[model samples]
Target: MDSRIKMENSMNMIFFGPVSSFMRIDAESLLHILTFTKKHLIPISRTILIWDLITDGKTAAFLYSREYLALGPLLNFVPEEDLYYVNFGDKSVLSFFANHNLGLHSRKYGILAASYRRYYGDMWYEDSDYINELGYLICGFPAHIISKITPAVFKKIDVEIFKKLSLCSVNQTKTLYNLATHKNAYGKPYKWSSHEITKLDILFICVPKESISSIRLEAIPAISKHIMEMIHQDKLEYFTKQQILRMNPEARRMYIIRVQLRTSLDTSQIAKQDANAIKKSVPLALIYVFTLILK
Candidate 1:
């Protein structure tokens, strides 16, 4: 906040040595500089320096893939009238975006995360690599099939399914799930085919039922994968926590449906006397319909 400190931060460029010297410096002044810094005057290295210096991730995320980074955050330096240009497609920039937490409020976060998955096939979850994959699968696949997949299940899924799930559209994933679901309906394990089985199919056969559903739908897979890990460890009670309960409403609804299905199924395994409890837990009308169909 001091004048000299602000000028010192502004003149950071003049201290031409290893970045280590300034890396620990507070970046508030540098963030101030970002306000008046012209498109051409923007120094890539200094920006990276600010990214490293700033402990709070939101501010750090604004430095690279500049345009996409600017959309969500309110920065004093970046004038809305001025068009900031940066190539988001570059591999290095993509990697940078992939690593940082850009605060979930950004609308473009889902698309950028998908692009990151496309360029690098790192699996965010054991079964699916990107959140978008889970979203598409939830919108397209049958919930019954999704519930059956456990880590111990020895189903061989295609290697390319991960990439396809992350990149494919809703209709594409839906069509693929339909193919696999139709085959599975015939009372046998559907043979997995890389050509015939799509990423959505693999996701249905892998992601936890509790994790499907999203307002955007493309981002559910990421949330699912995160929740899937907790589920695997028998941490079913984790969802009762406030943070988990406060997730996107659509996702919460989908998860609640999953829990209801599980509860209904479990009740069916008990004696006739327990049937009354199931009716109290799930809406009777919905339970009756699922019973007639799912049974």
Candidate 2:
């Protein structure tokens, strides 16, 4: 048989057909299989495959791929060492973390940050070699480490690397954003231009309550829709009160009418079933939300 045919048959037996046909596999063997398969590792619900990936510490990085990002919530409960090898540089991987609230103060976020820091050191050149400090920016160093890096080494780094940090606090994001924009403004002024605002992406979570207009009309589409909506909502929110007040009386009247129409439409968008659920719970809990309304 031809080489392609042999490879296809092997894949079929390994994944599509009964995976149990193979001899009993452990985490180390699974890592070997994954590195050989590379992108060919299909995203399947095979319990044994997921089990091996989560049970072992070193196998985590070897299992790195877009397919496994969906396991964020499940990984939250697994041994931290199991996630020590996760690739934090990828936007998709970060999205997986952001959607799951893996940020500063999250107990689960430590291993991920530590992994990135440790891997950066491991990937560094020895004393005899040229230290490609700039080259390491692509590794997506954690925000804490980024803050601690020496200025000489840090200046060699690009602003884009700061935008890519795994998790950042509000102050950290604000400081980085200022450096990125050269604003250096104290207390994070909200007056930056629209172009600069769009670059925040996941970092925008740091200022979730700010006026949506500061963000671009189109949210960062590369990540999950849940994340994109938070950014895009700014475009969807009504214009600021100052802008409305600045309009001529006639224009202001028209704007008020438009706002009322929008309010009506937004009201209509609410699911009737949700209201019905609320109604059913009101009798039991005096109209409090999910906690007082839990099923």
Candidate 3:
């Protein structure tokens, strides 16, 4: 599909589906598009940490158990925070470590192993021979490993990019790196209700853009109205029964209708008996659902 077409229809479009290879438009590109679209784009309040791309001793070991056993000690000394901001070419070295373990146990391990050999070359094993001269070399491991490795090894390894990126300044890089790090400055943590989570995935991840805005607005009111009406009409028990049956067909046949009615009656009776309860419940559900859909 043409990316531009998707962008034009919806300000929010995932370039790649989740669990697949993808490249998203960066924040700067997003801001420019929003400006041109002139649509009141709902801002993403939470920062998205691509933890899948972060590599350290713990992550490395998790992906490639044996290979990580061999290289884990060295990677453990590399400061994770430092690599967060640096641009290490088209494919960052950090991603290499993060993705390495993934390949170790992969069905295509040979392909990945060959790729790593070609990329890093034999320079990686040079540490074994220069152990004394490069005591500092072991320091190239993950941050957790820094304390374990010799100080001299740490000194010899070139970590200039790591140091520069950690300080929050790099030539022409601007501060875009804030998206991955800088918690308070960029993204906040969002606690979503189950319904809200479902809405977000459908609107942002599944559906096309032209339909999202309309579907989102309609879904909130439709769901709220259905819930409220069911409660007032004492049909909640029947609805609940139907939902249960839909979820589990092996439930006892004798209590099926009775159980459903009981659940529906509970909700319906509450709405009929308590005006304040109905007012309070529906709005909260609507708001929760709306926030996620709009996200």
Query: After superposition on all CA atoms, what RMSD does each candidate show versus the true structure?
Result: 16.0, 12.5, 23.4
Highest lDDT against the true fold, candidate: 2
Q: Give the deviation of candidate 1 from the true structure as CA RMSD.
A: 16.0
Considering lDDT, where higher is better, how would the candidates rank from best to worst?
2, 1, 3
- Write one digit per residue (lDDT tens) for candidate 3, span 242-285: 23233222322322333333333355467576676655654543
Worst 10 residues of 2 by lDDT: 284-293
* Candidate 1, 191-225: lDDT as tens digits: 33223323333344332334322112233323443
TM-score, predicted candidate 2 vs. hidden true structure: 0.37
Q: Which candidate, 2 or 3, has the higher TM-score?
A: 2
lDDT of each: 0.40, 0.43, 0.31
* TM-score, per-candidate, Cα-based: 0.27, 0.37, 0.17
lDDT value, candidate 2, whole model: 0.43
> Which residue pairs show backbone clashes in model 1?
35-77, 131-222, 132-218, 134-221
Q: What is the lDDT of residue 261 in candidate 3?
A: 39
CA shift at 103, candidate 1, in angstroms?
A: 4.0
* Model 1 misplacement above 4 A: 1-84, 99-101, 104-189, 193-202, 205-295
Could you tell me the lDDT of residue 208 within candidate 2?
39
Clashes in model 2: which pairs?
212-234
